[model samples]
Structures are given as C-alpha cells and as structure tokens.
Target: MDLTRTKALPIRHGKPKVLKMLLALALLLPAGFGIPAQTSYAAGISKPFPQQVDYPGMIKPSHVTQNAMNKSVSDYYDYWKATYLKHDLSSLPGGYYVKGDITGDPEGFKALGSSEGQGYGMIITVLMAGHDPNAQNIYNGLFKTARAYKSSGNPHLMGWVVADSPKAQGHFGSATDGDLDIAYSLILAHQQWGSDGAVNYLDEARTMINDGIKVSYVTTNNRLNLGDWDAKDALNTRPSDWMLSHFRAFYEVTGDAGWIQVIDNLYSVYDQFTAAYSPTTGLVSDFVVGNPPKPAPEWYLDEFKETNQYYYNASRFPLRVVMDYAFYGDPRGKAAADKITGWIKTKANGSPANIKNGYNLKGTAIGDYATAVFVAPFISAGTADSANQAWINAGWDWMKNKREDYFSDTYNLLNLLFITGNWWVPEGQAEQPIINLALNKPAVSSSIEGSGFEADKAFDGNLMSRWASNEGSDPEWIYVDLGSVQSISGVTLKWEAAYAKQYKIQVSTDSSGTPVQWTDVNSTTDGNGGVDEIDFSPHNARYVRMLGSERGTPYGYSLYEFEVYGTSSP
Candidate 1:
C-alpha cells in the first residue's frame, strides 16, 4: 500500500493497441496524403488478439509523462515486479511465498483471516500475469509451492494449507481465503503467461472452489457459509462475492465457456443471498443465513432482524469484493457491483450527521466508503457511461465534503489513488483544476473557525468540525491553488491521528474570496480505525477546501490537515 509518485511511461491507450494489430492488413502506399503512413507493428501475429499486452515492445518509451491517468495501470503492475521478484521462495517455508503485506499474526489485523496471506498472494499473482517478466516469475514461484504442498492421489490439486500453523497462531483449517486467492491467482497467471508450471496451481484453485461449492454452499438456499455449518453457521457474504471475482478472472484468462457457467451459477447464489439487504434503511445485515433466506430476527438489530448500526467500517467490504469480481464482465457480477454501489449511495444520503471518533464501525468514516463509490463509475463507465458519470460526481462530492476525520492510516492512501486514476479524463477537458499536493510535506493542518474564535486561534473556530473524531482525531485544513482550470486527475489525504467524516470544499477564481461553486467530497470511514483517503477527477474549479463535518466526541467542528492532488489539463 506504500505510495510514491514516479514518472509515467508512454504507451498508446488500449484502443490504439488493438487498432495497431487490426490495421496490419491494409498496407498504405501513401499515394494520396503527402505524409507517409506509420507502419503496423503487429503484422505477423495470428487472428484473435490478446486484450492487453505487458510490453508490446521492450524498453519503456521516452516522453511518456507519468500522471494519474496513465499511472493507475502501471503502478499496480509495478508492485508485483518490485516485491515478488526480489523475494526468493527457496528460503521461505514450504516454498510458499507471501511477497509482503502478511503480518503473520491472525488476531492483530481484522482483515487477516485463516488463508488471508495465501489468498492475497493468489490475487496478486493473477493480476501480475496481465504484464510480462513479472508474470513468468509469479508462475514459477506458484508452481514450486504447489509441488511442495501436493498430497498423494491429489491429481486435481484440491487443497492448500494455512500459512499460520498451530504452532504459530493456532491454525483455522486446511483451506481458507488464502487457498482460494492463491488458487485463483495461479490459474490466472497460467492462462495469461501460458507457462506449463501454472497448470498445477490453476487446477488446484479450480478444484478447491468447486469443492467449496459442494460442501459449503447451501444449495436449497443458495448461500455461502463461512466454512462448515457445524463449526461456523454464519453465511458471510464477502468471501462468496470475492470467489465470484476469482471465477470471472478465470473466464477472462482461459476464455473457457465452462468458467463462465461457474460464474453464472455463483451469481445465482449471490442473487438469493443479497436479498438480505433491508429496504427501510439501506444498510446490509452484518450476518445473514436461512434456507428460505428469511429476514433478520426481531431482536437481530433492525426492523428486519439485523442491527440498524451494522459495523460502518466494513460497509465496502462486501461491495469491493463483489465489484472486483464483476469488473471482468459477468452480467450477474455487474449486478452485484451495482448493488453495492447503490447501497453506498444510500448510506451517504442517510448517514448520521455526528459520528463517534476512533475506528469502530459507527465511530468514523472509513476509507473504503469513498473507494466503493469511486469504483462504481469506473466499473460502469465502459457500459453505462451516463450512470458512471453520475456515480463519479456523487462519489467525489461525498469525499470532498467529509474526508478529514474518517481516514486514520496511510496504508489506504493507495486505494484513494486507484479511485482517482481509474476515472481520470484525458487532459484538455474544461473542468475544475485540482491543487496538486506537495508530496514532500506529506501532511498539513487546519481547524474550523468558531463564533468566538480569533484569526490567530489555531483553527479553533467550529466545535462540530468533521475532522475531530477520536479514533485518530487531530484537526487541520490545508489546500493548494491549481494555477488554472484543469481536469482533476487524482487525490490523497493523510491524518496524524483520528480519521475524518465528511467535508465541504469550494472552488473559486479567488482563493481568498467566497467560493464560486462548492462540491461535496467525503472520505471512506476506516473499518480498522486508520488513515484513509479519497480520489476523483472533477473537470471544473480553481480553489479546493476541506471542511470537517463530524467528530467522534461531542466536541464540535473537528478539523484537521488536508491534501489536494490532480494533474494540469494541458
């Protein structure tokens, strides 16, 4: 999650890449036009081209400027290259590799589950195969691990063991998120890289997913169980949704019709499970299970039987996992993605004005809220451009108005960057100019002015500032003045302590004058009570402001440091 700005490499957009391949047919004599036509680079390749290439030609191009629009895809690929390439698997236990981000302590981090490390490893590996060199390395490492973990008579490659053993943190079971994640990752890498080694991992991941279907999925009800019904009866929707993403990736890599069938079946299961969402208040149930998939019990926590205040922190948990799966182009997958995005909009509209501080679900705005909203537009833009635009505006508005008190950790800043880069408009659109943040400083402070506050009162103005929540509360506001009107490309905000809730940012021709227009930007509430960030491209404005709205404590007007990020239109 560590984010550092780096120069971008120049590569043609996706359209040009496909065009370069297709136009290989028509050789131009250039008899009509005075200028010579550029030669096609993909003349020799066979029909039915690959969707994306890691490096069509070797040696990164010169003059490619690195910015939010181009860097999103590049940076994701770079993470795998830098981390996994340098770390060798021979020294690691069982030849299994985590490639970093594994704390190894199961109880310390909430996101860390039984197979979390291996699961994350799998996803990373699959995503890596989208590029080159890195794909080869990932394929090799995964195969080595598979061979070591292979059991007798296990031709289908069904099981993967937990990274944390009984001696380490008390093992949960043989298979968990880690197995699914790794298995899926390996399959994707195999398909993309086409390395013989990848077959073992892909076969194993496919086997494990199907087995989970047989043992854990409730056929009559069409819901996914936590693991086994005897030990854990709870049917957590997040993991099931994540599995759908794995299936979608498998389909994209293999182009196998059967994989699509698997994805469709999973979506059918998801359709029945997602019925748990309450109509009265858009909050999804914390736990949902039933043969008929009945509503929550009366004492459960809401009018529907679940609690009204389900943990606010993991609100994006279900949506993000589901959307990642849907991004690969499944109809039902897209539905799941839409469901989560729609739910988030409702939460933003109905959220309590005053939130408690610190990292509790109800305490502060977690970073994922912004991400859930932000990703909606990106996922839908190719298919539903208008709906995507609306989602982008709403997501950016929510983040701009209230981000200070919600983010308490720096790790999530990377997520913010993803949101910004994904929706970025190519330069030269009439839009609000985003104030490029000074990366060297990392943080700046501000406080809201109260009725009795003096000019020099250290931002001690409003008592109800949104940035003053307790989980990581420390307030301040600071911003940048974009020299001119430019399409905003991206943004990232950091906090010294407590995360922010919501804020009001104004853009004007005059930095010190009244805002000509205002846009609402809200940050995601951190589920783990840490620093969070939001990102987007708003093609209008010159000045931006972060106005804190809620604090964890009764103390009013919590304010804190602010950040502005974007690229110039020219």
Candidate 2:
C-alpha cells in the first residue's frame, strides 16, 4: 500500500465552477419547505447560489478579517497553481498523467501509486479550469491515468494505485473514497465545462455514477462499502468514506432514491453518535459499524484506544457537513455544522489556535498539535455559523503558507477556496479571485551577511532558497512586516539541516523604539525539519518574527523559507 492509503475525508462543507444552464432564481423545495431561490449570475446558468453568513455583533473587532482571508486564499492558490498543477502533475511513461507528491525517494518512486493523485488532479483541474488555460487537457491526462488503473473485479472502479507495474503497490485493487471524489468531480466537470468537444462530460459522469458508483454501492443497507473487496456487511463501512453532500448530488443526477436514503442513514449515524458517545459536542469518529453506523465503543486506532475519536479520517466531517449547508442549506447539515463550530468554540476557547490534534468522541484532546488539516475544515463550519467568524478567520490564518503535501495541502486549499469565497458553485455561480488582497508586505530579517542566505529570500515567493543565520550566533531572527496592523494566524518555516531546534515565533505592532515591543505567539523546543507549519491565536500586529535560540546541528539556525499568513474580519 502507498504511504497515503488512508486519506482524510471531506464532508460538511463544499465544490464547483459555474455554468448557465439549469433553473435560475427558482425555488428548489424538497418534499415541503422551499429554500431561497438559487440566483444565477447574468449568464443565467443554475449552479449553486452564493450563500452568506450573518456574523453576529460587530464583525470589525475580530482579528480574522475578510482581507486576511482573501490574502490567504490568493497567496495559497498562486503558490499551488504552479506546484500542483504545472509542475507536480507530470506525464507518465504510459501516456497517462500522474500527480506525484512523494519526493526525495531512494527507489525513484517505482512502488508509488498514483490513484489518489489522479482523483485530486481531476478535481483540482476542473476547479481551476476557469483560470487555467490548459486545465481541460490536464484533466484529460489525469482521467487517462485513472482508467489505466481500472480494478479487475470492478472495471468501473479504478485500481486504488498506479505503480510502475500493474501488480505493484496494490494497483490491482480499488479504494472507496478516491473513486467517490473522482466521480463527483466528474459531475462538477460536466457542469463546469459541459458535455462537449471530444469528451462528453455528462455521459462520462453517468458512466461513473452508474457503472462505478452504482455497481459498488452496497444496496441491502443503503450505505457504501470500503471497496470492491469489502463484503458490504454491517461491520465494514468507514465513516470517513461517507460524504453526505456527494450522496445528495448523486441522487440529483441519477434520480436514485437509494442515494437519498444513504444520506439520511448517514445523518442517522450522526444522531446515534450524539446519543451514544458525544451528545452535545456531536463529534464523529474515524470508523463506524452496523447499519445506520455508530462509532466503535471499544476499538483501537494507532495510539487511540477509542477508535471512535475524531482523528485524521473523521476530521473531514466539518468540511463535508458545511458543504451541504453551503449548497443546499439543509437543516440537518446546518445542525451538523453547528456541532463542530459550537464544540470547537467552547472546547478550544473560541480560537482554533487552542484546538489540539484528534479528540475523543466525548470531546477530549488526544494530545497533538493543532494541524492545518484539522483547522481548514472548521473554516467551512464557520461559513454556516456567523458566531464562528473569528474562528473562521483563525482557521484561514492557519492556512497561510501551509506546506503543500498530499493530504494537508489538498484539504488546506479546498478549505481556503471555500472560506475565502474563491471556490465556485456550478451554473451561473460567481467566485472571488484567489489573490493577495493585502498590498506589498515586505519581508526582512535581523541581518543578512552572505550570498545565498539573503534575508528577503525566504519571502521572495519562491519555494526554494532561505535566510541562514550568521554562523556561531546563538540568537538569530527573521521577520515579515505587513505594512499595517493585520490579523495573523501563524507562520510556516521550511528548514534545512541547520534549522531551529529551539525557537520563539513572535509578533510586534511597533517596529521602532528603544526595545521593540514583541509578544511571543508560539514557541518550539522540539522543531522538526521539512515543513514546520505552526499556528497561534489570531494576533493583530504589523511585524511577525522567528527568533531562534538554538540550532539543530553545529551550524547556525537556517531556514529554507519563512512565511507569515492569516485572516481578519475586514
């Protein structure tokens, strides 16, 4: 299996690019209640209507600002537009395109599979098609790769991996989550690009929905199985695999009543969790069992004795639930979204910076750092709850300069796109641009004394290069000044061997004076090399600095790059 065999899921929040073909400004009522008429842009295509949250109180004081969110979204898209799309997505020898995230491998990525890459590639490509000129071609390439790895048992279901050989790295089998997203992305692609040219988007979506999804969906209990191999029994469903919004979309497209039942059953699972494990908090677990699945009471997950806790897999519930609200405004969806917002606000003291990694179903922290992936989805939760505005701001702040990897990067950008209002709704939908709304924010360090170790290199918007401290120095610092007092979430430090082993990330409002007033936002005595993305409570400051006290090796503290990012209510 690949290193990324178990992936975090996307739920609660939302996807899509706008098209102008469906019912525009018409009420879409399900059974009884009528929702607000979904309005389309001048194009008159009926995509998802844009939604707004009524943040209570004065939205001004919150450090999480609109401009900050915009800046975060813009900076991230620009950084990833090239890396994930242009560079990382390369053509394979088999004439299929693979998006490879694994780097610096001794075996040259031979055993690495590319199914996850194929799925995400298609999703991102379709989303970026409006801005990217070569998006369609790239999507076609990725689709080819997906087809190349077709599962033998179920032809429609793709083999979970695509390695050097057909049998290598489980390339012979399939996984449920990737295929679901890939099919859903194809549906969005149909709406975004239309069934035209050489490729018929609508027809292809139908193929995936019928041939792939229909064939694999476990019919007896109205739930999805793990994959083709799973017996689709009571004890088999992965909670992370349940994406309610995608199920709804599936119902809409296929007119299959079973899909709706699947969604209803999923919500039932949510209800069961509230009653059994976490009543008020409503936290979901990573895995579930039985029909109308409930969390495993006495199960083990890695280090967690209670496998039902919200860990890597279940962190996506917020993202998934919020999407249902963002698009359909389902009351159940709103309730689910509120569970996370209320829980985080109450548990983390109303700030995402305080939230820790993983938690028991009863709302107990599993003693881990607040990761970018965990925080990103909550931003979607904030979209449904205006009271979560500040928290949403804090979440976006955490995404700033978030290191791009297979999992966190994917979730971060999706969360960024949604929270920042850059993600679109298909058919007559409008989207804000993903760009730095914050003007020229110059980056400077305490000192620069070398050819390659320039202070500005860290913030040059380049992935490579850095600011190395003067050798023999115990205390070295680098900082970024945002021209004005802005809401900041945290900073990302990419390090080499001579990195910070002990450091203090601090901020200051006044850069001048005898002793510049600085406040420590976050500190680390055990700093890991690679991408060290750290978050803090929302801070309003003009200056952000990384003060290193000790180095990882004999050499001075060196940073491949240092980045400051966050959002504000503005």
Candidate 3:
C-alpha cells in the first residue's frame, strides 16, 4: 500500500461487541498472556515543565512575562490533547494514538494518526509532565500503540500509519522522522523518570537506536534515509531529517561514534546545498538528491510539487539546525541558522505575520499566506543570534495563542518549548552550572517601563521578568549593590528586545561616596541583543552598573536578568 494513499478503514457496527468479548477474555488470562501491563511512572518525573533552563548561549523573547509564556504552552497543550489524542479502538485498549485531521478526505477513510504524529505525541507528553497530571499515562499509551504497529521492514520500527478496521493491516513501513523522535523520547523518559520500573526506557532506547535506527534508517554513507523502505535509494534524503541534536543524543546514549559521522555528513550536505543553490537564503528543498546533493526534481517521489522548494518538510529545517547551536554550540549550525533568519528578517520587514508558508531557494516567497508551521521554525532560528532579538520577540507574539491544524499546532508547541527555555538537555548531557552572584541582590535603575517592571526585577534571576528603561531614552542605567565591596570577574546580561547598542560596565568601590567615583571596567560599542557575557579583570566594587549610551532598538534598554559572577572580598 502507498504510504500517503493509505487511509483508516471504517469501523463495523457489530465489531464493538466482538472487541469487548476479546478484551474481556484477554483480561481473564495470566499476567504475561496478552499485552504487557501498562505502567504509570508518575514518580519518575524529575525535570518537569517550566524548567526555565538557562541554556548557555541561547536567547528567548524577553518582552513577555514568564507566566504568560508558560500559560501559552499549557493552554495549547490542553486544547491539543483534548482534540487530537484518541483511544477509541477496543482492540488496543489502554493504547492511545493521535487522530489525524480529515477535513478534505474525498474517500472518507476516517484517518487514524501517522507514526510521525505518534512520535510527536510521545515527546510532547514527556516534556509536559508537571503541567499535565496524566502525562505519564498518556505517554505510556502512545508508546504501546507505537509498538503494536511495528514496521514489516524493521521489527524495531513502528509502521507509518494506523488503520481502524481490525481486518486492515496498516502501512507496515517506517518513516525516519517518526523513528528518530520516538527513540529520542524514550531517552527523555529514562531521564525524566529512571528505567527501574516496568518499562526500562534506557534499554528500549538503546535497542531502538542501535538495532532499529542504525540498522535500517542510517545509510552506509552516514546520511539518513527517508524511511526504512527508502534505504535502497541511498542518494535521496530529506533535509528535515538532518536532526543534528538528536544524533548527538543518540551518540551520547549508545556510545556510538557512527552517529557523529552522520552529523558531520549531513552538515557537509547542508553546506553543499546552500553554497550551490541557496547561498543567500540558506533555504533547503524538502528533498535533496545526488552526490553533491542538489534539490530533488519536481514529482521526484510523487509526494508533492514543492519538493524542490522550502515547503512543509523543509520548514522544520531551522528548528532542527538551531537546536544544535543552542545545545552544543556548533559554529556550523550557527552559521547556517544566521543565513536563514537574517534573510527572513529582511524579507518579512521584521514582522513575523508577513512570513510566507513556502519559499524558493533564492529567497522568493512561493506561498503567500502566513502559517505557524513556517513561522515557528524561524522563531527557533531567531535564538541563534542576538541581532534577531526583535524578530524573535515579534515571532513569539504572533504565534503564541493561534490555533491551527495538527501539523501546525504540534510544531508550534515544540518550538514554543524551545523558545521559552522549557526544553532541556537529557540528564547526563547537561551543561556545567554557573553561579550568579547578583541573583536576588538589591538593584536600582535609572527608569522603569512601569510599576511591575522595576529595577530589582533584573536581578531576580528570572527569565520571564525584566527591567526596562524609559522609552526612546538615552543615558539610562541599572546598578546592583553587592552589599559591600566584593571581587567581581564578569557579568551576564539577558537583554530584552530593547537592548543597548552601546554600554559600559562601570564599577564604584563606594556606594555613597561624595564624588560617587565610577570607573569603566568593561565597555562595548557593538552590543547585539541576546545573552551578553562580558568578563573583565577581577575588581572589588560595592556597586556595578550597566550604563547605556545608545539603544539597540527604538525603545530603551531592558534586561531580563543582569547576572554578576565573583566572590566576596576579604
């Protein structure tokens, strides 16, 4: 059966009774008789939602309150969960699946969900543990459903689609994207809760990664094939499947260096395609083919006409690429991300609403309307540089509350998690800790945006809250008192969209001296917005201030968190 053409079979009227009888008989059997007992590992949740992790080099939209950001995710998940999550099939009781949208189905197949959607559901539920009380249960049900639809080509992989009719066998082939995410989510589950329970998540992840993915999906050239069935066609590859961060995680868990080769190979392919076809925009086609890797021709796989353009599949490129830079700090990833975001910022005239759905390699908009599927990835890409801070902020505002179709909504939630700093690295792969000396310290500013955004908010160690100076102002400043003169080595400024283009880190030993002598310990004329980490020679000062000379944006300087690092003076 054609993967795309296959649809869910209609349910028969009398089948419910038969299914109920079957379920009743199965329940009466021994412990290991039928489907394994579904375990709810609620106690295993370690890192829950609202993690607000301070990713080392990534930036977030600083204008909105953190509560608002968290609400956006929670509200959307509630809607998405209610609408798409389904468990009606009695054959797979306690097994859930995401229901695919069927608005324009001519044949009325009553579509069940795809393996891709199943993968997405698993990842979303695991990440949203704290916010949703039934997250673990939902996640386990999704996992059971995925396992039931095992791929014919590879037993370790799930089939591409699920059908409703008991007689109809679903498409027992695997899509690479589904397998990749499913395996990654298992690792996250292990980290979130441990492998000691009924489900050994880590062990399952290892089997999937080593036996399922490495054996079937990964080509000999270290490039990812589109699916398990597409392994014979080694040259044809999907740009969105170049998930570098996932590959890194796979390597981390399996201790396989081959995944590293996969990462390097795909990065080279990305470089080759961009340099040859899209040097200016850094946009990739949905499908890329050949040794040098050119965009696949129209009707290449009979998927769609826009395979050669940056359509639905390639729309995910930015989110995938930017995560590598955000998590691992890969310069190549940053360089690739900058090319796409910098062009989009100019193309959209700094408005996220103006972003189109599809684009040609040369940066021309192919699709006229704006949708979250296209816009959300750009928001993720915006985090790659501080220069795109305003663009990132605008993108978040545009995408936050909008409800679209399943594909759009799911991608939007995933991107929102990354944008709001809720997405975290797995347990063992986390970055080193940084101590902020100025956290919760006494602070004062030259001006404030309003009553709530006061001077002290900048020192509260919260990413959601910020302190803003008066609009369109010059010579604004925010200072933190260390209580007494203390040795300080550096400061990190998590700036809002309204950042300082020119600023100085000035320190004074005496907080209430007659002359109020202040010396510039560090200064910069070229300050870009994101997270600025400035280090200077260790100096003992009771007061430290960021003196802004010129604003980066039209508004005044603002900071989410103005962090100081050092030890107390002797």
Candidate 4:
C-alpha cells in the first residue's frame, strides 16, 4: 500500500456537500423518519467507489473478487448485509427461524426479531452507516429501544427471548449479553450521534457491571445463556469466543484497570475450555450438553461434560476474539487469537463441500449455525498488515458478483464500515468497488529531541510526534496532509489529556483554508484520556486537523498524534 502527503485545499465558506446516509432504525428517523435508504435513494447512490490507486497503471478489474486464502473485507461486508439486513424484526419466531418467516415460538426475546430488534440492529447499523445521514435514524431507534429496556429495568438485558411475547425459555449463552455490548451501544449513541442520554445509559450500565459479571461468571458452564427476567437457563450449548471483545469494550469505555485484570484472567478459563471443547479433528464443539461423546478422549469422557458447557460455534467469538486482542494489546489474547486464526485458515479453508465454510473458522463441524457473517470484516480489519493484505487480495475474488443470503439494515451498513471503515453505501447496491490509496511518504515538520521521545523499537513506527495542550494555548491543534485526493475512511487520534472542557476535530480539502467541514467524532476533554476514532464515508480531500475546543486542565493541549487510515500503499 502507498500513502502520499498532498497539499491542503483553500479555506472557504462554501457549503460542503450534504451527503447523509440513512439508517434503518425507525427511532433514528427524523420526525417523519422516511423509508429505507436503499429504496429512497437508489438512483442517487453512486456505483461502488474505488480507493485511490497508488499505481495508476494498475489495471481495473471488471468483476468483484476475493482472496483464495482469506475473506475480502468488502465482500464480507456485502455478505453480512445480504445475510442480515431487511428481515422484519417483529417476525422472528422466538429464537428460531425457518426460511424468512417466523415458524417457531413467536414471543421470543431475541432482540433482532421484534420491536426490540430496532434497537439491537440499530446498534450495529448506526456504526456501519459511519458518516451517512441515514445513521441518525438507527441512532434514534437504538436509543428508543434501549430506553424502553432501561425503563423496564432492563429485563432484556438479562438475555433475549427466543419465543414470541418475550418469554425467556429460548436463548443461547453468549457473552454478548454482557455490559460490553451495551457499552458499545452507549458509545455509539454519544460518540456517533451525540445523544446526551447516552452517557446516562453508560453510567447505568456501569452500575450494572456487577450484575452482568454475576450473570456471566456465576454460570457453571462457560456459556452465558440468554434469558428474560426469571427464565435464565436455556442451554443452547454452542461454542463462541467473543468474551474478550466485551472486555475490550469495557476497557474502552471505563478505562478501569480491574476490567483489564478480569479480561486477562478469562484467558486461563478460555484455555481450560479450549482443551475440553476442541475435538481432535481440529473443530471446536459448537454446543455441549449433558451427554458426552462415546469414547471421547479418556481425559474428558469421565468429567468432560461438566467442563464442555461454555461453547457456541458462531462468527462473533472466533473472529471478535482476534480483534479484541489485536486492538487491546493483550499478549495472551493475541496468542489465543493466533491459534484460532491458524485453525480457521488451515482447517476451515479445506472444506470444499461447504459453500461458505462452517461457522467455525477451523472448519470443524460444531453444528450450531447463525447469520452473523460480520466475522470476515472483523478478521480482515484486525489482521496484521501483510497477512491481511494478502487476504484482502484474495477475498475480493470471492465476494464480487456473488448473491447474498441475509440482507438487513444492520448487516449491510456494517459491511461497508468493516472493509473501508467508511459507512457510505451507494444507494441500493450491496458492494462497492475496491479503493486504492496513494503510497504515503511520512515527513516530519518538527521533532522533539529527547531519549524519552524516541520511538519504541517494538512499535512499527516510533511516536512521530506528541503534544500536550495546556492553558497557555489550551486548544492545541495538529494537522496532516495526504498530499493527494484519496478516498479516506477513518482517523484514529490519541490524547493524554488529564482533563479538558472539550476537544473537537475538523477536516478539509484545503491546507491553508478553514475546515469548512467538521465532524464531532469524539472527546478527550473529560473522563479517561485515550484513543478516539472518527469515521466518515470515503471522501476526496487531503488536509486533516484536530484541536482542543476546551481547556479542562491548566495544560494547553494534550495530543499524542493523529493516525490516518486509508486503502493505500505506505
């Protein structure tokens, strides 16, 4: 990949193009929340846009493609959207489904299949929608349902009902029922949509941590079975590995060291589960129950059932576990993710019979199945540069020109975010064309000369620059130019401010000009200072700037550096 530093655009008061992508959440819809974006603006949506090509001489392919060894990020996004979006949440028959119709219990508390689903799906849809205006509705819907649950004392928080009418009898024990997912939802609301209520929701969720921990940890099995108020035990013993993701989210929102400790401790428990749950054939058992496999490894045959309980073979855990470690920097977590990734690549990829391969990355048949195809994007996005790059090369081959199974508001938007990290989906289209960015040659305008400022040898690139914004010039600013027009998707900023009234960011195509366009992506002004993210649809511009809007501490501006992400050679 290539990255280039282009000049900035001239500042002007001209109105930046008003490009708003709509989300599917009814609550997110403005007063008269309109129909789906796909139906409302298909004609206006652009054909799949391509990343800026570093090598202009590179030939343009006519069809979509994917890597032979790994899943393509864009294809995976399309796959996720095709597999989940557009389904009527109210129609899910409890926790089960046949065809597209609800055939089983109707009163299930499954969050995605009813009015409540508007909230559940909105959580995912809003994030996936990125900077699109459509995300507003999903954000609204998410809060609406979350408020309903919170007002009801969060009965659904305990778990979702698999039947119609909110009965708790049918539920799978996955870590998703924990506070982390809720924390993510809160972050999305406040960070993405700027909902004031989101913080209160986060606080309430923080208070409920003990309850979540109790419900998740107290269970004898590794699985955290889903349920309503009184009905907690519906053992759908499938194996999943999403525990750490919840931990990562907890750490991201709370900055609590205890949470990190808790996450570190789970690795041991995970090891135990892995030993008991993994079959010699390389596939981890999806769900475990009272019955033990006859002639099972003698070590487990006698007491294995007791240990085998916490398993669910779904896309969330196997993939998200890797993502959590990669993002959170847990050494053990990284090792575990490595093992699982290897298993998926070596074992799962060998299955020629399975169309999409089994849910388990290792390809071993654990039996339980689900529609969460977001696995590909998480894996693609989180992978190490070379490895992911190769997979990206191959995955594009598979997704192009393929028909999808589950199409929904949530999954479709998410697909876009995972690959490009930008959330714009040209109207009606499922997949966007590949984007290639110009190779970047990082330049240093100035450097802080000190041994302490030296880059960590372990780090890919040493801390290029660090800033501490304080009272003197409270709102400090940092700017960078990609030097060329490219389809930029996301920006990751780090801050070390102890306290600040507010911090804001602005972006533009002009270098010397004012930021005519700004997005309030996050805050480092108050609370725990850490990394923040701003995601936008792939846009053509070069100049980027981040500055403090308020001074919480006596120090002027507290900034580490700005890390820009895009599809280009570096």
Each candidate's number of clashing pairs is 80, 29, 1, 106
Kindly list the per-residue Cα lDDT of model 1 for residues 1-570, writing each as its tens digit.
Answer: 000000110000010111100100111111221212223323221111112211111111122322432343445435434543333433344344443332212333232112333444444444433334344455455555543443222322312332323222222223333444555655544444433443554455445545443344323223344333222344333332335555444433332223333344344434554454433322333334454343334323221221222332223234334333223323344454455545444445533221211112222333233332223222222122234444444433333223221111111222223233221111111123334342223222253233422222212211111233222333434444555555553443333223345544444455544344556544443222222345554645555555454443334332222334556553
Model 4, stretches more than 4 Å misplaced?
Answer: 1-104, 107-120, 149-180, 195-201, 204-241, 255-258, 276-283, 288-312, 348-382, 385-389, 399-403, 407-416, 419-570
Global lDDT of each candidate? 0.34, 0.61, 0.77, 0.36
Better by TM-score, candidate 4 or 1: 4
Q: Write the per-residue lDDT of candidate 3 for residues 525-556, one digit (tens) a residue.
A: 99977567788899988889999999998888
Please name the candidate that would achieve the greatest lDDT relative to the true structure: 3
lDDT of 2 by residue, 22-124 (tens): 2111113223222234443323122322222222211221575655655555566566655654323233443344434431121333524345556666776
Q: TM-score per candidate, in order?
A: 0.42, 0.61, 0.67, 0.45
Error of 2 at 50 (Å): 12
Tens-digit lDDT string for candidate 4 (50-93) = 22111111111223331211133334444544554442335332
Between prediction 2 and prediction 3, the one with superior lDDT is 3
Cα deviation of 252 in candidate 2 (Å)?
Answer: 2.3
The predicted structure with the larger lDDT, 1 or 3, is: 3
lDDT of 4: 0.36
Point to the candidate with the largest TM-score. Answer: 3
- Sort by TM-score, best first: 3, 2, 4, 1
Model 2 regions lying over 4 Å from their true place: 1-71, 81-114, 166-170, 297-306, 427-570
TM-score of 2: 0.61
Ranking of all predicted structures according to lDDT, beginning with the best and ending with the worst: 3, 2, 4, 1
